[model samples]
Target: EHKRTNMNEAIVEKLHGTLSILRRERDEVHRAKELAMERLRLAKEETERMERTLQASKQKYDALMAQSTNNSNSNSNNNCSNGSDGHGGKVNESVEIMQLKKEVERIGREAKFQHMEYVSKRDTLAKLKNHLKAEDAQRSKNIRIAQETLKKRRAKLANIQALARNHISTDGTSGGSASRGRANDNGNDSGISGGAGKGKNRTSASASAS
Candidate 1:
């Protein structure tokens, strides 16, 4: 029974340790999840801003293309009327239009990339959530087992006390028996001494009479 109690206590200790580890892991997982969510939110906001920039660039590019068409027509009429060159203006307008188009494309690519990153991180967060759920389940199970073992330990404590009392009582009984045995031995020695003294006295009287 004592051995069983020791084993129970060991199991309870192990379960307690396991609970502590699980709690630490749970806390770590929660922090990781929170960090991931913060990153995702920032990424989402950035993606939206990039998309808005892309749209503005597209609108500007379209306006430049329309203006280029109008300027070309106006330059043709002015060249016919005043005999002047407008090639430099056209070249600068075309370059501006091209730059705006490129900016639009670049912004679009960046928005798409940020979106993909958000999706991947979101998936990772889901996995972490599932792992946290499993950890909670295991921790709860360990708690229940520990509680049961503690009850057994309490019962074992009572048994141990009872055993100690019985042991003390048995030792007291044995000590009393040993003391009685010693008294009997002392009584026998006294009787033997008395018989020897009487025999010595009888011999002395018989010798005196002779």
Candidate 2:
């Protein structure tokens, strides 16, 4: 009989130890999830910033292109007027027009390069967005699994407590104090679980806002 009682006590102790370990693991996973969410938020913000920069660069490039065209037209008009005066002026005007053409070509090339850079940034942003979505989905799955595991663990713990109480009562042992202690422990566990739930809700809200 004494051996049986000792074995029952050992079983209860083992259950308690397992529950504590599981709780610690759950906490660690929650922390890791929060870190991943923060990183994803930062990545989204960076992508938005790049998009704004790309838009500004495009506008600047367009303005420079239009100005180049206007300058070329003005130079052409000036050359036509100077052609009525002399051959020397015409030759000088021709050189000036060549220089202007070279400048316009250089500006065009720069605009093309800028556009390519913008396209590259856009592609990078898209990849980052896709990566963030995948991470979010994975994180949600992990959290759901963790919650399910916790629920199962809680159920197991409750069963163990009930069995322990029943065994002690059947043996006519002084188990009231132990039962009360277990109840207090369960209350503490409930509080921890509630806090975890609140944290999860807050995280969800933040993700939605982002």
Candidate 3:
């Protein structure tokens, strides 16, 4: 009877261990399933988010394309209004955009070239103007110097003329005084001769009377 009880106790312990092992395995599997479900849910949410983003990107692209088409149509209409063939109906928007890009580049190049030319011309003009101004200033200085010299020469000439006039007057007076002195001397000699002649005639008359 003791052997039977021991055997029953061992059996009961073995069954309990097996049930505990099974319960642990089942709980592990359930946890694993839950983790898998969570992962799937996260993947689904990410996919939906990506899809929404893609849809939004697509919509934005469509809107931009529509706007570009409208702008291109309007530009074509404007070109046609100006009697242009709007690219001759053979060129699409992309081709026209490329052509426009090339044209813009060409225009930019031309503008740059023109700007450089203008700068060069402006510099040349500035130099010319400076040179002209310098020449003018030099001319002005020369004119002023010439005028000053002329004024000085005129003053000298005037002084010389005054001195010449004074000298001429003084010489004329001296000449006149010398001529008057000579005339006085001649008259004195004539008077003396006349007196001598009268005395001789008187002496002869006295001798005849004696």
What would the per-residue lDDT of candidate 1 be over residues 1-210, giving only the tens digit for each residue? 567657756765775676577567767867877887788788778878887888888888889999999999999999999999799999999899888888888888988888788788778878877886787777777767766766777677668767867888999999999999999999999999999999999999999999
Error of 1 at 36 (Å): 2.7
- In model 1, how large is the Cα lDDT of residue 49? 85
Which ranking of candidates, highest lDDT first? 1, 2, 3
Q: Write the per-residue lDDT of candidate 3 for residues 1-210, one digit (tens) a residue.
A: 345445545554554555465456556655655565565555555555555555555565556557668877887788878876555443565565555556555555555555555556556555655665565566556555655655665565556666767878999999999999999999999999999999999999999999
Best by lDDT: 1
- Which run of 10 residues does model 1 get worst, by summed lDDT? 1-10
In the range 92-150, model 2's lDDT, one tens digit per residue, is: 65565566556556655655565565556556656765765676666666656656665
What C-alpha lDDT do the candidate models reach, one value each? 0.82, 0.65, 0.62
**Location of the lowest summed lDDT over 10 successive residues in candidate 3:** 1-10
Residue clash pairs of candidate 2? none
Query: Which candidate, 1 or 2, has the higher lDDT?
Result: 1
Segments of candidate 3 deviating more than 4 angstroms: 1-91
